[model samples]
Target: MKQPWIHNAKTDWWFILSPPFLVLLIIFVFQKQIQGLENHYSFYTWLFLIVFVDVAHVYSTLFKTYFVKAEVQRRKLLYLGMPVISWCLGIALFQFGALTFWSVLALIAVFHFIRQQYGFMRIYARFEPDNWSKKIDEVAIYTATVFPMLYWFKTPRAFTWFVNNEFDWLKNLPDYIGVITVLYILIVTVWIIKTIVEIIKTKTVNIPKTALITGTYLSWYFGIIYY
Candidate 1:
C-alpha cells in the first residue's frame, strides 16, 4: 500500500518534502539581511542557489537515465538523440536573440518546476481512489503555481528566473489581476471547504498531500507574488 510520507517522517520533513517551505521560511526570517545579495555576494549567492540547487538538480537527471545501463540500453536512440536535439533547438533559439533564448528557457524551467510539484502531490495521493476531489487537487496545485507566474508577468518584481529583465517583455497587461485574484481566492475557499469536509467525514487528513499543496501555495506566493 502507498504510504503518506515519501521516504519517512524525518527525511521527508527535513529534506525531500519540506525543503521549499523551509527555504521560504529562511527567506522570511532573513529578509533584511538577504537583501542586496546581487550587489554584495553575487558569486556566493549564484554558487549556492543557481549552481548548487538549480544546475545540480538538472544534472542529477543524468544519474537516473544515462548512468543506468539498463535505462540507456532500453532506449538507446532516445537516450542519445534527445541531447543533440535539445542542443540544436537551443542554438536555434539563441540565434533569434538572447532575450528570446533566456526567456524561453526560463519559462520552460518554470513549467518543469510546476509539473514536479504536481507529481509529488499525485504521489502523495496515490492511495486515494479516483474522484472529483483528485481533479480539484490538480486544479488547486496548478493554480498555486501558475497564478504567481501570471502575476509576475503583469507586475515586475525583484526576483528573476535566469537573468535580469528576462520577464520584462511580459510585464504590463490588461487589468485582469484583480479578476485573477478573485478567482484565486475562490479556489482557495473551495479547497478549504473540501478539506474540512473530508476531515469531518473521514476523520482523517491526507497529511502529505495537504502539506504539499499548502507548501506549494505559500512558497510560490511568497517567492513570486509577495516578494
Candidate 2:
C-alpha cells in the first residue's frame, strides 16, 4: 500500500504550486503598504545568494551521504559547526551594517542548515526505526518552520507595518500578544526537549545522528539564549 502522506504526480504539482500561491496571496493582501517597506537589496543579489546556497546545500547533502556510508565523523563536525558559524557571520554582518536583505537571507540559511541536519537525522532514524527519534524529528521540523516565521514577524521592519496600519482585523487584539505567543512557543519548546531526551535514551550513541541533533539543539539554544 502507498504511504498516506505520499502524493501522486498531479497532487505533487499542486503541492509545488502552493507556496508561490500563498506568497502571492500574502503580497496581494498587503499590496497597498508593502511597497513602503525598505528593500535595498537588488533582485540579482537575491538570486545569486539563493543559487550559491542551493549549491552549498547540494554539496553538503552529497558529503553527508558519503560520510554516512563510510562511518566518518567529519560530516558530523560540519553539520554541528555550520549553524554556529552562520550565527557568528550573521552577527558580524549586522555589526558592520552590511546589506540588511543579505543578513536576513544569511540568517535564514542558518535556519535551513539546522533544518537539514535534523531532517537527515530523522531519515537515518527511520532506517533504524526509533519512535522517540521520529517524534523528536517531527518536533524539530515544526519548530524549524515556526521559529523562523516568528522571528521574521518580530523583526523591527516587519513589525512596523502592523504598528503603523490600523487594520480592522488586528486593531483590537491584546497588547500582550507577543508575551502570549512567546509563552506558547516556550511550552512547545519544552515538549521538544522532552522528546529529544527520549530519543537520546533510545539511541545513545548513533554518532552521526547524535551530532546532528545535538548541534541543532545547541544552535537554537545558544542562538536565542546569548543573542
Candidate 3:
C-alpha cells in the first residue's frame, strides 16, 4: 500500500522530517560559530532566532488558519476570542509580577512545544493500527520531550526558556533528577529495541513517524541536555 502521508511524501518529508534533523545538523556543523555569534553578536543572534524564526512561526500560523476561510468559519469563536482572552490573561499574569508573568508564559510555551511534537506524531501514525508498537511510539515521544523538561524543572540549567531565570519559579528536585534520568534512559532504550524488532518483523519503516520520534529525541537531548 502507498504510504499515508498527510500532505504526500515529499511535502511531509521537507516540512516535518527535514526541519528537526536539519536543526541538529546545522548546530553540529556550526557549533563553534554559533557560540561565537552568541558571545559576540548576541543581539543579532536573538533577532534571528527569536524574532525572525520564532515570531515568524506565529505569523505563519495565520496563513494556515486565519487566512483560510473554512478554518476561520469552523472556529470563529476560537479565532475571534482567543486573542482577546490571551491578552487579558497576559495582563492578569503581569499583575502578579514580571517574573511570574514570564515564568508562566515560558512554561506555557514549553507545554505548547511538547504538544505540537506529539500532535505531528499522532497525525503520522493515524493510518497504523493502535497497538503495542504504537503505544511505545507515543510513550517514547512524550518521554523524549517531558524528560528534558522535567530536568529543566528539577535541576538548574545553564540555559533559560526565554529570559534569565524564568524557570526559577518551578520546583527544584535535584535529588530525584538522577532517578528521572534513569527512567528516561530505560524508556528510550526500549523504544529503540522495539523499533528495531518491529522493522525486522514488518520489513518496513514509517519514515515520517520514525524520523519525527528520533528527531524529537535528539532535539530535546541536545537542546535541553547537551546544550
TM-score of each: 0.91, 0.35, 0.89
lDDT of 2 by residue, 34-153 (tens): 444425554554456455754666668766565575534646666667779988877876675445535456446556765665655565455556575467556664564445444433
The local distance difference test score of each candidate is: 0.87, 0.50, 0.87
What would the per-residue lDDT of candidate 1 be over residues 67-144, giving only the tens digit for each residue? 999999999999999989999999999999999999999999989989998999998998898999999999999999
Task: Candidate 3: count the clashes.
Answer: 0
Q: Clashing pairs in model 3? A: none
Cα deviation of 96, candidate 3, in Å: 2.1
- Cα deviation at 179, candidate 3, in Å, is 1.0
TM-score of 3: 0.89
Candidate that scores best on TM-score? 1
Candidate 1 similarity to native, TM-score: 0.91
Rank by TM-score, highest first: 1, 3, 2
